[model samples]
Target: MLDPILKRIASSPVLIYILRCCIGFLIGYKLYITYPDFELFWTLLSIILVISPEEKDTRRLSIERFKSNFIGSAVAMVMLLFLEPNVYTIIAGIFVTIIVCRLFNVLNMARVALVALLIIMVQPHQTGFVEAPIYRFGSVAVGCIIGLLIVVLTSIIFRPLKRKFGIPY
Candidate 1:
């Protein structure tokens, strides 16, 4: 009876969700403690949530994420050079970023870039334009790395029920 119960618990979907949540929380917590920045850690968590490889619909989602991030960042940077760092300006920047990214067919990258740029631009510090871009780039890089790590780890552990799945990495 005990062995059957144990087997049932081990094979439960709830157990998998609980484990994934724990791993994500732990990773997010460590990132927050090390960086002491809410933006960075939240970005990492969002990436993990959105880009999970355990899902059957991952291919398109992954491509979209990459594209949005790339395009969004580029649009955000270009807009930054022309606008002051204010609430209204930030809103306008975001609008412009999305529109431009959509128009240019690189909306995935643009969306990520826009968020990164907004974080840098809205901060109180007078970090120069050069430094702002660098930080934004760095944040995206960190988010992507964390997201990829989450994907690989989850895939290896869960072994999703896909008919055919292969990752070259």
Candidate 2:
């Protein structure tokens, strides 16, 4: 009876997706609490943004989003280093991120890039204005890494379940 119930849950893609998200959240939360200096909201947000229900999408999107994140971080850091961290700086970061995304052919992923720019730029200047961008870039990078690792681990765990249950992609 329990085996049948377990099979039912395992066979449903929606349930599997929910489980994957729950796992990501748990990991993200742990990281959020574990490190004091890390701007872990980006980490949590990235996991949600990067993880996909489809394995292929998870692999593809993660790389693209990482590139987007990199662009955003680079733009924010450059702008903050030279200019004040104000509304004008954020506006410039957005435009810069968009342009960079287009040049890199990742314009479709500009939303995530914009988010990265905002997070890095808008976060409270706890460590000071100049250091904020550097710290946030590290946070975003960690987020991308965690999201990719979660995708790989989930794929490994789910493959056997998919095979056993005859689940379609």
Candidate 3:
């Protein structure tokens, strides 16, 4: 039993995932310090949460996420600038984000965009509308970039380890 367990641990996808998650956490902590906004935490969390164990198109995913984040942030900022912060505006912003995501055919990033909209529209942030979206967008964009970089860099570093350990990464 011990031998099998050890083999599985040494040859499974666990090490790569562990490395990616640690990288995410480190980046998140750094961003939290750099950006005074509390929303920065969640932006990083979202990126980390999306880190896949299976190999995929990280560049395409990052592009989709950034585009979706921008759409949501821009729409919410426009609404906040021109209108009052109320249920109608929030709902309108949500609807608009969904529509825009569909139009762009970026359904993969719709949820991310909606989250950006919520970050901008939901709370009466002390930073106000413009600043709030900007911060949210900044943190999210950074997280996405860093997360993809981690995946790429870690993949390179882990390839040899995977080979030696017979890991199925």
Best by TM-score: 2
Candidate 2 Cα errors over 4 Å, as ranges = 1-10, 53-56
lDDT of 1 by residue, 37-109 (tens): 3345545544554353335534445555655664555555555666666788778878877786678675645
lDDT of each: 0.56, 0.79, 0.71
Top-scoring candidate (lDDT): 2
Q: Global CA lDDT of candidate 1, please? A: 0.56
Q: What lDDT score is found at residue 33 in candidate 2?
A: 92
Q: Decide which is better by TM-score, 2 or 3.
A: 2
lDDT of 3 by residue, 51-157 (tens): 65554554456567767776777787778778888999999999999999999988778887888778777856766656665666566666666776777676676
Where model 3 places Cα greater than 4 Å from the true spot, the runs are: 1-11, 34-39, 53-63, 158-169
Q: Rank the candidates by TM-score, best first.
A: 2, 3, 1
lDDT of 2 by residue, 1-169 (tens): 7767767776776776787788888888899999867677778877776666764466677678878987887798888888988898898889989999999998999998898888788867677776778877887777777777777787777678767778754
> 62 in model 1: Cα distance from truth in Å?
3.6
The model with the greater lDDT, 2 or 3, is: 2
Where model 1 places Cα greater than 4 Å from the true spot, the runs are 1-21, 35-39, 42-49, 52-54, 87-92, 103-120, 123-130, 160-169
lDDT of 3: 0.71
